[model samples]
Target: MAGLRARLKKTIVLVGMMGAGKTAVGKALAARLAVPFLDSDREIVKAASATIAEIFVRDGEAFFRDRETEVITRLLNAQASVLSTGGGAFLAAHNRQVISDAGVAVWLQADLDLLWSRVRHKNTRPLLRTANPRETLAELYKTRDPLYALADLRVSCGADYSIDDMATAVLEVLKSRPDVLEISRDG
Candidate 1:
């Protein structure tokens, strides 16, 4: 019973850049797996009673990142659930460690052009407050790409991919690695 419970506590954390559909895919994956979905960004917003944009505008990027790290820490220690993190969440060493120690981490990879197209008009993204949104995204990708690559699995999520398709792909990945996940494909 202890072994069964331990296996059941394993979580799947989605790590990727902004506009990579982490939240969308996380929700679908959670539903497919019959687990709850928790977005760290959403959790932070709720905890602070403020939007992410407000946190960034008033507290600055570093401050917002600190809040994100705190939120991720709490969620990582929680029981079975799908966690969707912010774009820069994995960039922090401690944040990456928490994900690594907790459960399987999946990186949803998207190209810079696709990311810019998706986030260009979004005023809520503090990172995109730049003279050239494309350049800012490119720079962010360049720096964070390697960090995201540290995930246990990397899924190619193109610009127009559906949430269902992404969830299916993640399920397939888990199915292929049943030994690590302790989830039988038949189950």
Candidate 2:
């Protein structure tokens, strides 16, 4: 893994739904790769001095999304590491273009049921604060899966997979992309 860390040339951008374990698996993946772990949402919160939910309410989704793009672009340009993006961040064409140009986007694919199970109890998700949150999640799953498919690579997440397991899966996927990650045979 140390050799793998040395060979990493691009940032691994995790793009997926809120409950897709981007943050959790990203942290583990970064640890495994011995690189920094950055979250776009966390950066946004830091810059705004408010939570994502508050940002959406105070500034509006469009405003929040603009900030998200700026943060992502800045982070991707800085260093090679693992970056977890907000669910809707990849939906924007400009954001996708920037991510493709600067890093490798890896979609953490999970089914609606699995996503719902993971995020149902979370109050931090601003988009899931609807009257029918499950249905809303399903709708988001339907609409966003196609855009997510545009990612450079995809790693499926299952109910049986732990965070570390998912991180390993992402690492395996990264191994296939030589431009993004290179694995030394002597390691």
Candidate 3:
């Protein structure tokens, strides 16, 4: 793991649906690799002095997305770390390109049922504030899965996996991508 940490060559960006454990797994991954953990949503909220739900309500999604891109670009340029992005961030072509250029995007793929189980009670999700949130999430899952498939790598997420387990899974995937994460023999 220390060899993996010392040899990391690019940022590992986590992309997937809302309940895919990006934030949780990202934190663990960063810790295990001795790198920083950055959440684009948290960066946006910090910069705007508001929550994501408030940003969506006030500035609208387009505005927030623009800011998201800016933050992503800024963070990716700073250092190689684990970045957990908003569910919609990877859907943008420009964002995808930038991420591909600067880091490796890893989709934390989760099934609809598991996603729903994890996110159904989370009122913080702006997009799920509709009258029929389950239907909304289902529609989103259907629409976004194809785009999320464009990631550089993917790790299937299951209900049985803990945060550490998911992080370890992502780390294993990263190890397979020598261009993104290098494992030194000496460590």
Candidate 4:
């Protein structure tokens, strides 16, 4: 797939755990396809003029989620780009519907251990600010796995997969459906 031009006809919305590398992989995927990259979390922060943690602390998770849903809708309506969503965004049924209708939802599945190793040092995740964050993440994983499984595509994430590697993996999977992805010569 190297040096091939891939067209993302519909948005490629990444869904999964926080440490599953959605942002990194999304950027790589967008760059590889020569399309715009958008992160739903970043868009929410920009719209609210505050960090996600600050929004949660000031308003609440519900308010923040409302803003998340709105941002997802607005972005989907705005353009077809590589979009990385917050870990919890797909947990909302309405969000799932909106994404399903407008784009291909790819779940970047990673083991709990892998996810923990990636996010343990990060203070950016508000949901993991608890005293027992690993336990909380495990719980979230157990519940969200079923929902994430509802995605249009699934890519397993492991220590061996680099950001570009994951992006290529996504393209390989997309090969099955040319309606969603079309590849041509770079020049």
Candidate 5:
């Protein structure tokens, strides 16, 4: 929606597992389309002055999730932009409804092994803080797969795909939905 860049008629929300590259790919996609890139998790941390893990440890996941829903609903209703949501953001029916109403949700589908490899070393994910984090991640993956599939669109990723590659793939998929997104050229 800026300059000669692509025009986004609605918000584009990236939703998936922790290591699904939502924030990384969302930033690239927003830059490619010349739109704002906003991460709900980052916004939450900024507002609460604490990390997600800290929030979960203090106020609990339920509180963090409540804040997540509020931030997501507010961002989705803002100007057209790229919104990268938390992994569990779409698992909630209320958040899903809000996203569906004001934006297009894109699930960055990736296999569990790839997701594990990407997130195994991250201490920021409170959900994976278990005796067997890998097993926990697998459980989360299995439980959330069906929910993530309910997204408006899906963009598959692999160990070989880079952030730019995923962004390009998402753009290719978005090209078909001219009502939501459109490529523009200036004379």
Candidate 6:
């Protein structure tokens, strides 16, 4: 049987709601760990040759989600890397299963206040294209938090924290969890 440390060394995947700082933390974490970083949403945008808003306006959410799954699958099959997924990436059971099987998933958590502070100005989030952005964010957070908890690790990503600080904290947590690290390495 593969050791825990080996199974968990494959990749570090950051999963959380938007404004939880997945991209920022994933980049910092990858740099700290000396690995490449990939944002699944960015990959999807590049592949579709369209922004997320455009995708939602044209192809709709289901189409965009299918594309997202494809991008995530490819990323998981790649070499060692840090992957940051969209807010909704882990909501799908298939996507979550892929993440669980292919990498160590970390959930960067923040309360509604922190999330509103970070994303209130971000016009790019398709889900936030609403009359009441804060309410939408709160609703999304309520739905996503439970799914995020399904990840292998969870870290509080408060507004007071820096990406580097969060990255270090995640590393510390991963280091202490030899069983998870082993799963990622050997997966």
Models 1 onward score TM values of 0.89, 0.96, 0.96, 0.96, 0.96, 0.90
Per residue, candidate 3 scores C-alpha lDDT tens digits across 99-123 of 9999999999999999999999889
At residue 41, give the lDDT of candidate 2. Answer: 95
Shift in Å, residue 34, candidate 2 = 0.7
Candidate 3 C-alpha error for residue 113, in Å: 0.5
- Would you list the C-alpha lDDT of every candidate in the order shown? 0.82, 0.93, 0.94, 0.93, 0.93, 0.85
lDDT tens digits, residues 51-148, model 1?
98888888888988998988888887887789899898889988888888877788999888888788888888877888887888899899999989
User: How far out, in Å, is residue 186 in model 4?
Assistant: 5.7
- Scored against the true structure, residue 10 in model 6 reaches a CA lDDT of 71
Between which residue pairs do clashes occur in model 4? none
Please identify model 1 stretches exceeding 4 Å from their true place.
1-8, 185-187
Greater TM-score among 1 and 5 belongs to 5
Per-residue lDDT of model 5, residues 133-155, tens digit only: 99999999999999999999999
Error of 2 at 161 (Å): 0.3
lDDT digits (tens) for residues 84-148 of candidate 4 = 99999999999999999988899999999999999999999999999999999999999999999
Candidate 1, residue 69: lDDT = 85
Worst 10 residues of 6 by lDDT: 1-10
Report the C-alpha displacement of residue 105, candidate 4, in angstroms. 0.1
User: Residue 111 error for model 4, in Å?
Assistant: 0.3
> Which run of 10 residues does model 2 get worst, by summed lDDT?
1-10
Off by over 4 Å in 5: 1-5
Q: On residues 1-187, what C-alpha lDDT tens digit does candidate 6 reach at each position?
A: 2232333367788988888899989998777666788999999989889999999999999999999999999999988689999999899999989988988788998888988988998788889989998998888988878888999888997777888789878877787666545334443
Give the least accurate 10-residue stretch of model 3, judged by summed lDDT.
1-10
